[model samples]
Target: MTVSKKRTISDESRVFQEKWSHNYFFIQVKEKAICLICQESIAVMKEYNLKRHYSTKHAAKYDMIEEKLRIDKLALLMKNIQGLYLSLKTGHKDSEASIKASYIIAQKIVAKSKPFTDGEFIKECMEVSFEILCPAQKQIFSKLSLSGVTIARRIEELGTNIESTLKERISKFIFYSLALDESTDLSDTIQLAIFVRGVDSNFNITEELAALFPMKGTTKSCNIFNALKSTFNRFDIKLNNLSGVITDRAPSMIGKNEGLIALIKKEMGTCGALQLIQYHCIIHQENLCGKSVGFQTIMKDVVKIVNFVRSRALNHREFKNFRSEIDAEQGDLIYFTDVR
Candidate 1:
């Protein structure tokens, strides 16, 4: 029998040069190449085995490293883009403007009596109205504090702004007349309403409701005067600018000795103004005159009949329906009050 000889490759004849061979560490021992990365031996000592090892084992690591670098670079680019957008939109590189913008938006919301937590409002603005807002504006809204307390503070700020504006405008007026009236609301709380009519430097009329002072305790003439004085002092309203005072025929309002009008006149006299014209409300005078007419008996009968028709629920509904069916111009009788 003939014996077979084993084939062995020599290092001198082995082809180690390959494109992938440079990427891996190799060791040659006994004419066999060993791949350091995979810790495996190459028996035949050819480029194919090394290339196959690299493609199969270490190719995923290369791909992963490349993907990670790409993702990191992309993330950095996006960050720079966001920073550029913010710089372009807000006109500032800071978040301070967001606070002022939020307050302004809150002021409008409060002025319009909108619900403070209406997230749908912002959503609608983002989607429809303010969809063209720049990235900075979007970022501002995202970082804003729009809680209920924040809204409430904004409302107070709005009121302060309004008061400041009113004070400025009122200061431009040379003379102003105060129309004051006291009345009780449905809750039986006594309220003193004061309005001012003034002419500006341009001779334009400016009429404003000055105050709605609540009278908690005794509403005597002294208390009324004190309240008016406090309001005037708070607003820096000058007594020298007082031109006229008008009020209803209430004793506490117009009494010569201790009335609010008399006290104001006394203060004006001390300030050296000759006279502050006083006038009773024309409506009150007309109402007083109407009461003196000789139609009291007829008024009583009319009131009784009107009450019979309007006081009962069924009668009131039937009367209303009849009036509608007949196309009556005056559907219900006019309500009258006994002032006396």
Candidate 2:
């Protein structure tokens, strides 16, 4: 009889062999695998013995691995769904916060006539909140605050709301009157400021700034009348409800021949006319009277001193510090009035 050759297998096949110990046996402690049920070396790459071992000893473990894989897949899917939901909720909350904060900022900016792009103002608000707030509060405020575009948009929204509210109040009034004055701003643009005064069912008087129309061409009586008519039309205000009108003593406004008052009276006619009273502004009359008081010399000296203190940067700074040092109640030295 001839001797049989000894079988051999690959040494590289021994990685993690213990994890499959129920089916595979180790000839060495960490190497040389053999099938547990078949008693044959797996190193020889024998498929029959491995398949037999699977059928006999490792069937339960194979089922457990498949179940674990499915559970793991389901858990990962749920985690992803939860993350998506949280992301959407956070975005909605941030949007609401922006709108709320923008509303307040818009009102304050309009009331104070502050610039929308004032970075110093926005930074100051952020910095103060950052310093005073706790970590959670800081997180909440990170979404709130100002940007120039956001401020502009919110101002428009608030303006619409205010206009609607004023319309509601004005519509309920029994009678309403208009007061108008034209003035030149620092830019030399003539702006006509209009105000409406209304009496409600209870006779409560409500007064509000109606509009500021810029006069483009000649600001004659007819032009002023047209501007007023356009503004009333836009607001749906009836000229017949107007019970009174007030204006400054300027000749263009009160002159009998082609003045704003005369034009208004003519356009209104007799039927539309009620007790349409007209009055010159008392403050303007007093300002005119103050001119004859012989105080020109004193007023000129006061103006010169105020200009000296305010026009020079160093002098202005020193004066402010001096006032602070002395604990002055008023920070400024002069309150100039438009007496001219």
Q: Relative to the true structure, how large is the alpha-carbon lDDT of every model?
A: 0.75, 0.73
Task: List the candidate 1 regions with Cα displacement exceeding 4 Å.
Answer: 1-88, 91-145, 282-340
**lDDT, candidate 1, at 276:** 90
Per-candidate clashes, comma-separated: 0, 1
TM for candidate 2 is 0.59
Task: Please state the error at residue 164 of candidate 2 in Å.
Answer: 2.0
Q: Which pairs of residues collide in model 1?
A: none
- Name the runs in model 2 displaced over 4 angstroms: 1-94, 119-128, 295-340
Error of 2 at 250 (Å): 1.8
> Candidate 2, overall lDDT?
0.73
Best by TM-score: 2
At residue 251, what lDDT does model 2 achieve?
A: 79
lDDT of 1 by residue, 1-340 (tens): 9998766565247666543334444546466776655547888777777767768887676545445574564445445655655777765534576577668778778768888775336644664534475653464455566667777787788878877877887888888899988889888888999888888889978887778999888889999998898778767898888899999988999897988888988888888875799988988888888888757877899889888887788998888899999999987765678888
Q: For model 2, give the RMSD to the true fold.
A: 20.1
- Give one digit per residue, the lDDT tens place, for model 2 in 145-228: 577887888889888888888888887888898889999988888999999999989988889998899997788888888989
